[model samples]
Target: MRKPQQLRNRELVLLIFAMALTLGAFVLVQFGAIGELDTKVLGVVGIMCVLAFALHIVLRIRASQADPFLVPVALMLTGIGTAMIYRLDLAYVAHWNVGTSNAGEHQMLYAALSIALCIGLVWSLANYRVLFKYTYIFGFLGIILLALPFIPFLNGGGNAVVWISIFGFNFQPGEIAKICLAIFFAGYLVRTRESLTSTGKRVLGFTFPRAREFGPLLVIWLISMAIIVLQRDLGTGILIFGMFVAMLYVATGKTGWVLIGVFLAGAGAVAATFVMPYVHGRFEQWLHALDDDLYNASANASFQLVNGLFGMAHGGMFGTGLGQGRPDITPVAGSDYIIPSLGEELGLVGVFAILALYLIFASRGAHVGVAGQDDFGKLLSVGLSFTIALQVFIMVGGVTRVIPLTGLTTPFLAAGGSSLLANWLIVAILLRVSDAVRRQPRAVIG
Candidate 1:
C-alpha cells in the first residue's frame, strides 16, 4: 500500500490544478470577481478539498494497490461542478438578487458529503459481487423512491413533480433512484442472462423472449407509462426505461429485446402525446414552431425553448462571454436550461468542449466495462456509463432543438444538490469497479 503522504502529494496537486483552472476561468469571465469573497463558501469548499485529499491518502495507504486514475477523475468532476455552480450563481445574483444565497453553499456541502459517502461505499464493500445480495431490496426501494414524488403530500414542483420538499429543502428522488436502478439492473441481468438468452424462441430473424423471461421489463415499462401518465414526468420515465433496455440488451446480447423495448417506448410516447395535455403541448410546440397561430397564442409555453435557441445562435462560435450574454433571460437557466446558458456564455466552442468532456468520460467508462473481469462489474460499469450518456444526450439535444425538450439535468454541471450527490456516488461506484478491474491477475485462465 502506498503511504498517505505519497497519495496526498498527487491528490493535492490535482486538486490545486483543478481549483486554479476553475477560479482562473471565472476571473477571465469576470463573473465571480465582483462578489464579496464569500469566505464561508470558500471555507467549506476548502475543507472539502482537504478532506478529499485526506481520504485519498488514507485509501492509498491502506490498499496495496489502487487505480491511479480514480482520484484525478473525481477531482476534475468536482472542480467542474463547483465552477459551474459559481458561474450560475453569478447570473443568479445579477438578475434575481440571489447573491450569496445558500445554493452554492449547499452545493459545496453536498459535494463534500457525496465524497465522504463515496469513500465509505467503496471502502466498506469488499467485493463487487456483494451488491447482488441486496438487489431485490435495492430495486424495490428504487421504484418506491421514484414513485415518491407522485405522492400528493410529498410532491413539489408545479410543471413537474420530480421533487419532494423535506423541511423546506427540496430533493429530487429520481437522481438517487438512477443509481439504485442501475445497481438493480446490473445484478438482475447478470443473474438472468443465461436463462434469458436460452429460453427465448426464434422467429424470422429474431428471438422472441418468453413472456415470463420478460416479466421485469414488462413491469418497468408499465411503471414508466404510469409515471408519464400520472406524474407527467416523461423525461425520467424515458431515462429509466432507456437505461433498462440498454442494460438488458448488453446482458442478453439480443437485438430483439432492444427492438421490443423501442416499440413499447414509441407506443408509450404516442399514447402520452395524445392523452397528456403537457406532453401534447410540448410536442405540438416542438413540431409546429413556425406556426404563427400556435406561436402567438402559446408563446409562454414556447418562450424558454425559443429564447434558448436564440441564445445559442447569439453565441455563434466564440461565446458572448460570461456575464455579458443574456443567458439569465432564459427561464430556468441554472437548471434544465443550463447548457444553453453555457453556450451563450462560453460560446459554441465552450459548449463543444463541455460535450467533449462528457464524451471522454463516457468512453473511459466504457473502457472500464470492457476491461472488467466479470459480468457483474462489466454490466454495472456499462449501465452507469449509459445512464450518463443518455441523460446528457437528452438534455443537450433538448436545449439545442435536436429533440423535443425533456427536462433532464446535466450530470455534474447542473446546479442541484440531489443531482450532485447522485452523480458523485455514481463516479464512486465506477472507481470501485475500475479498481477491481485493475487488481485482477492478467494471466488467470477462465
Candidate 2:
C-alpha cells in the first residue's frame, strides 16, 4: 500500500500542474501579442490559482479515501475552461468596444465557487446511498425548479426562459434541475423496473406496457410538454425526457421502453413544430435557410452555423497553434458555441482529444455503474454518465449542424457559472458512487 504522505505529494503535484497550465496559457496569450492583457486580470487569476491549490490541500486532508481521479479531473477541467475563457476575452477586446477583463474575472470567480461547492457536496454526501431516500422528493423539487424560470414575474430572456435573476445574480434553474432529476429518475427506475418489465403485454409486434406502468412516463411527458410550452426551451425539455428514457432502458433492459420513448419524442416534435411559434421558426430556419432566411436575407441563422463549420474546417488536423486563429469570429465563443472556438484555436486534433477525454470519463462512469453493489447505485452511475454523454452529443451535433442548433452549454468547457457548478456536483456524486463500488466486498459462493 502506498503511504499517505506519498499520496499527498502526488495530489500536490497534480494541483500545481493544473494551476501552471492555466497560468501558462494566460501568460502565453498576453505575451504573444495576440491580445492585450491587463495586470489586474493576471492578479485575479493568480489569486484564483492560490485558492484552488489551498482547496486541493483541504480536500486531500479531509477526504483521503475519495476517488483519486476526482479532484485531478475537476482541476484539469477548471483550468482548461479558464484558459479558453481568457482566450475569448482577449478576442473580445480586439473586436468589440468592450472590456475583456470582466469575462475573465467572472469566469475565475465562478470556477472558484464551483470548486468550493464540489468539495462541499463530496464531503456532505460521502455515502452515495443517502440520496436514494429522497429521490422522489428531489425529483418533484427538480420539476418545480425547472419550471421556476417560466414564472411570469421571474422569467428572463425572450430567447429561452432559462434564467431567473435573484438578488442581482442570474441563475439557471435548469442546470440544478437536471442533476436532481437524474437522481430521482435513477432511483425511480431502479425501484419500478421489475414491475414495468413483468407487467407489459405483447401488443401486435411491440410489447405494450400496462396503463398503470405508464403513469410515471406519462407524467414525465406532461412535464416535458410543460417545459416546451412555458419556457420555450425545446432542447432542455427533450434532454430531460430523453435522459429519463435512457435510464429506464438501462434499469429494465427493455427495448419496448426505448421504442415508446422514440415514438413519443417524434410525436412531441411534430406537435411542437405545428403549435409553438418558436419551435416552428427554428425548424423552418434549419430546413429552408438556403431559400428564405428567417433572421433576415443575410442568412444569420446559417451564418453562425457556417462560421462554426468553417472554423472546424480551418482547424484541419492540428489547430492554428492556439491563439493564432480567430476563434472570436464564431458567435458565443465563450458559451454554447465554445467547441468550434476550440476547433478554430486548437485544431480538429484538439477537439478529438477533448472528445476522447469525455469518452474515457463516460466509460469509467459506466464501469462504476456495472460494478456497483445495488440497483440504485448502478442506476445513479449510469444515469449520470448518460446525461453527460447526451449533453456532449447535443452540443457537438448542434455546432456541427448534424442536428438543429440548440443553445446548450458544453459541460466543463463552456463559460457559465451554473453549468460549471452543476457538472462538478454531478462529477462529485459519481466519484462517491465509484468509491462505494471499489470498497464493496465480493459476493461469497457455495
Best by lDDT: 2
lDDT per residue (tens digit) for residues 228-334 in model 2: 88778888888899889888888878778888889998899889989987787667656764553453444335666767778888988887766777777887777
lDDT of 1 by residue, 6-25 (tens): 54566557657766665455
List TM-score per model, in order: 0.88, 0.89
Which segments of candidate 2 are over 4 A away from where they belong? 1-17, 33-43, 46-65, 99-101, 203-208, 288-300, 443-446
Give the C-alpha lDDT of model 1.
Answer: 0.76
RMSD value for candidate 1? 3.4
